[model samples]
Target: MKQSLTRRAMLGALGTAVAATAGCQSPGTGSDSGSDTGEQPESADAVAQSDSVYTNVYQEVADAVVSIRVYAEDSRGGQGSGFLIDDEHIVTNEHVVAGGDEYYVRFADTGWRTASVVGADVYSDLAVLRIGATPDVTPLSFVETEPTVGTEVVAIGNPFGLSGSVSAGIVSGVDRTLQSANNFSIADAVQTDAPVNPGNSGGPLVTLEGDVVGVINSGGGDNVAFAISAPLTQRVVPSLIQTGDYDHPYMGVGLRSVSPRVAEANNLDPGSGVYITRVVSDGPAAGVLQGSDGETTISGTAIPTGGDVVRQMDDTPTPTRQALGSFLALETSPGETVDVLVERDGAQETVELTLGTRPEP
Candidate 1:
């Protein structure tokens, strides 16, 4: 039997490319407009002033961003960029160093150092490296809060292995669910259009003030780019640094968003919750959440009904599979009881299951 690669694994290795050359809005996405010719100010200083917003941000951040060149069994090797998080650690996308036997770090001054993967988390597409502590190398500050839509952002990375490359744009969206190289859907990713491309994965997405808001993860389609949020990094990096992995609570089940047709067939309102699709055998959820079996027709379509619809988790409403996964990650450990509200038999009931820890990739 051939083993199938998970979306998370693929994304961890390549950062999920936008699926098509076409488009997908991903819920809250919208188009942005530029200033019209008439709205443009005549004074050069005015234009300079707006442009200056990103000047210091990039200068201060570029020093922290370093080129990562990974040498694998495959000939030419691969290249990406990462930023210094501290004297001893460098952060980059897991894909950058994937399948590598050796790693190299290069600085803007043409300085180079040998490096190794301290740890990496494929599910989050984050990896860290250990290099000898160097002086005068400043780490970029992380954003304390979520970046808002329209906030000016900048991307500094090694696009196509070209170091010190910089591009600018605004926060295009927030909280998007996208597949990681590891086949797991990374919840709440920050999307930007800072001209990110291959080799940009693992770079820092900085705000106008130079604070790191997100880590570059993937790019494609309509010039879109995605990054894992800083908060998610805050949760995963320490563990990766210490153990090379982070424990994620698991209640083994496959799920999908509840569509209007699914809602109507189940006699529930559409746009309300996520529908459970399958339960992994012997998993934590198997004994806690009951599965229903039937054949039902919705809008002249026949669909199998086996799994339950999840409405909430721990009193927190989970409207989609992404929301459920996000909530699960927020919890601390395995054996911890979390309340899950499910829809069944024309009613809602809460089931408490002690989540189990999934093995790290």
Candidate 2:
């Protein structure tokens, strides 16, 4: 269930978000050479000169932007933003189109066209839409290189159903981890401070050069929003457009990050790594990684004891779940064999496991 951005609320794919609505919410240094240098102040008399590049970018992409209204058989639905990826395909958040079986996409100049879902990936919060009618604006272009922090970004979406609304800002951060609407992990997400209201979820996060860098997904706090990065979009959209699905690598285990108190109470190293709480049946970790064999009391509570602690993966030290997720999402594809270093019994051992394709949730 996707909530309106106006509510400042989020609906996860696998879990429910209990927080209240948040209010609505960078320069390119080289991809990795510099960080965002906070905004500069201008004099009162300066009518902030409008950059010609920005105007050209907007004029180029605006006709490609559309307002998506999704409706179920029961007539229940909500609106979100989307942009044409090509003549017939539009990209939007999975959450935006997941609720309804039918859709109507309204373009800034072309009025409305019927559309159907090509595919929706809950793990990445992305969906591909196919419209029968031809698009008015040119297809969006994406740069393969990552957008660095502090690069100027422009977001054009149908915020609050105001068609073709645009907001500008910088890439605040990158290579971030965010929980998907489905309770899974999305690695290498981009963070921005653009004003993203309820209808901006599927819009394009465009660079000053008019390249699509990210897909605006959701927002939190004041001017803080998260987007699915261009890399993931580039990787998954082709599969979705062709096959109506995408498969991701999966370990299939429940993990809990080690804490100082739990480690000290169990006489184990504190902050050493994450614990294997439970391994799914027939999952990649099944019969390879073991959970706690017993219970241990710590801080007046009995916590699971004797579980295998995973210290690293594929020769890289993944002390945290975030690190592990980054490796799985960004580096490896399904069917790859990886080495997992675990602390079991007393000594350490490396376990070899073949990654599996994540089954549809």
Best by lDDT: 2
Q: State the local distance difference test value for candidate 1.
A: 0.75
Give per-model TM-scores: 0.83, 0.78
CA RMSD (A), model 2: 10.9
User: Each model's RMSD to truth, in Å?
Assistant: 11.3, 10.9
lDDT of 2: 0.77
Poorest 10 consecutive residues of model 2 by lDDT?
A: 12-21
lDDT at 290, model 1: 63
Give me the runs in candidate 1 sitting further than 4 Å from their true place.
Answer: 1-51, 181-183
Question: Residue 15's C-alpha lDDT in candidate 1?
Answer: 19
Over 1-361, each residue of candidate 2 has an lDDT whose tens digit, in order, gives 1111211111111111111111211111113322356544443322122213344456666777788999898888888998888899999999999879789898876777899998989999999999887754678878679988997778888778777667777899987888874467888889998777888889998875678889999984687898999988888899999999888999888887777765764567646788878888889989988977687777788887788888888878877777777678877889999999998876789999899998778
